[model samples]
Each structure stands twice: as C-alpha cells, then as structure tokens.
Target: MSLRDRVISTSVESSADPVELLSLKNPVHFLALGFGSGLAPKAPGTFGTLAALPLVWLLIQPGLWFYLCLTLIACLAGAWICGHAARDMGVHDHAAIVWDEVAGMLLTMFAVPLNWSTLLVGFVLFRLLDILKPWPISYLDKHVHGGVGIMADDILAGILACVGMHLLLEMGWLT
Candidate 1:
C-alpha cells in the first residue's frame, strides 16, 4: 500500500479495536462501531458509507417516517460520538469515526424504494456527492465544527443523493 494508505489504515485499525475503543465513553464507542471503514486507505468516506448499508437496510424496513426519524437520531448521536472520539484521539475528524456516514446513508435512502437497484444507486450517488462535497456540503464541511463538523457534510450529501435517487425513480431509470 502507499504510505498515506498505510498510515490511515494503521490509524483506523488502532482506533476501531473494540478493546481500545470501548474504553471510551458514549460517543467514542459509537464511532468505533463504524469500524475502520472511515479510515480506508482511499475513498474513506465511500467505504464508510458502504459499511453502513447493512445496518441502514435493517433500520429502514419499518417505514419512511421511521427511517427518517432514525436518520435524525443517528445524526444527532453521530455528532456526539464523532466529537468524543475525535477528542479522545486528539484529532479533528479522525478517519475512524464513520457513524456520520451511517446517518448520511440512512438519510439518502429515506422515502426511496427499497429495491436493490435503488439501494445501489443511492449508495453510489451518496458517495459521489460526499466525496465531491458539492455546494452546501462543501460549505458545511468547512464551516462546521465538533459533531456538526463530522455530520453536516454527509447529511447534505445524503440530501443530494436522495434527490438524485428520487429523480432516477421518477424517470424509471432505477429499474
């Protein structure tokens, strides 16, 4: 692996170890549960979002309102978890805390069809917008701090992803 990749991997691995991670209080543990997905050698954000898919799928089944509620809760909790974890690690937006991605992905899937094609498209679109940080997402990433810092950009990306997915659905392109 490349030097940068190796370093990020090491950081993520170290941070995600439950033994090491659980020693922390509330938010830290949640952040660690996201695993090292947030610290991928490349496309960490995309990896993080992908890592959340299984869990998101599980949570989304109840209904759109439930899913959206869960998304809001996750977003609020993610801020705490990410902030605490980042503080413990003595870093700003450490690569290991990916709960933000979890929340974002859930938001992206909100009100969208639960089919494989839609899920796949949502995942891809969310990751793209997240990585690109278009418009308000980019602005939020720069301007926000703490838990908001960790969660805001991804939330905005999720919104964009949702819009894209909705459009695709309307166009019958997701089938």
Candidate 2:
C-alpha cells in the first residue's frame, strides 16, 4: 500500500517507523526526512544534523553572511516542511521528520568559523542544549505548537550553543 493509503486506511494501524515515511510521495515528506537521514532508527535527529554538516560547511565557505542566508532559508523551509509532514503523519513532531535538527545544527554553527574541533564542540553543545532545553528553550518547547514550535526549541538551543561556543572561543578555551 502507498503511504497515503497507509495513512488513510486507519484499519491497519501501525507504529511510526522512520523508514516508512520514505514511502511517502510528498515533497515535504522528502524534505522533512532530511533526504533520508531521518530514517535512522536511533538518533534520527542526530543523524539529520550529521547529514547537515557538509552542507553547513559549504555554506560557511562563502563566509558568515552567506551562511546566515542559507541558515535562514533552512529555518524558514524547515517550519513549512516539518509542519506539513507532521500533519500528514497524524503525529506531532514525529521522529521521522528531522529537518528541524538540520536547521538547528546549521544555526548552531552560525557564529563560529568552521573547524574540526569547533564543529565537535558545537555538535556536543547543540545536542546538549537541544536535549536539555534550558530556560527559554524549554519554555518554548512546552508552550509552542505545530512546526514553529518544533523548530523553535531547536533554534533556541542552537542560539544558546552558538553563544556558548563563541564565549568559549573568546576565552581562549578552544580554537
């Protein structure tokens, strides 16, 4: 059965499988899948962010302004794509839809110049803040709804990570 059929049947209910979302025909679904990175059974969000590294690296190659534009596009696009995909899936913030993570990671690395060590620390910090959802991040995650809500928390986490990473760099802690 097609993904549409599967979604509509309602008779043969099944669990939300990340891989199963790939069968969907919607362009938004494909986008929200992070080009299939979200199919990972474990840590799909991490996998989606990992898939974003090369693109983020390329975006930064042109310098910060260009990177910001690209990251901005991702954030805007993520809200639309993730929102549509979640609605289609009949689930809120389904695990299979991780374009939010890609956008989040891109935002996380925005302030820092691309480097192996910098990327490593940023990754850890982004994941930590995203998972921990400190202060305003947690507040948004709880209060917000829909795609904006899904993406907002991560965006805040990225901002926090970028700030933290920048502070650490300025402190001569990591280069």
Best by TM-score: 2
Clashes of each: 1, 0
lDDT of model 2, residue 148? 94
For model 2, residues 65-86, the per-residue Cα lDDT tens digits are: 9999989999987888888777
**Once superposed on the true structure, which residue ranges of model 2 sit more than 4 Å away at CA?**
1-26
Clashing pairs in 2: none
Q: Which ten residues in a row have the lowest lDDT in candidate 1?
A: 17-26
* CA-only RMSD, every prediction: 7.0, 2.9
Q: Name the weakest run of 10 consecutive residues (lDDT summed) in model 2.
A: 15-24
**Please, what are the lDDT tens digits per residue for candidate 1 over residues 24-112?**
33546545447656656666667778888887788877877887787888888788887766655545776667778888888888888
Name the TM-score of candidate 1: 0.79
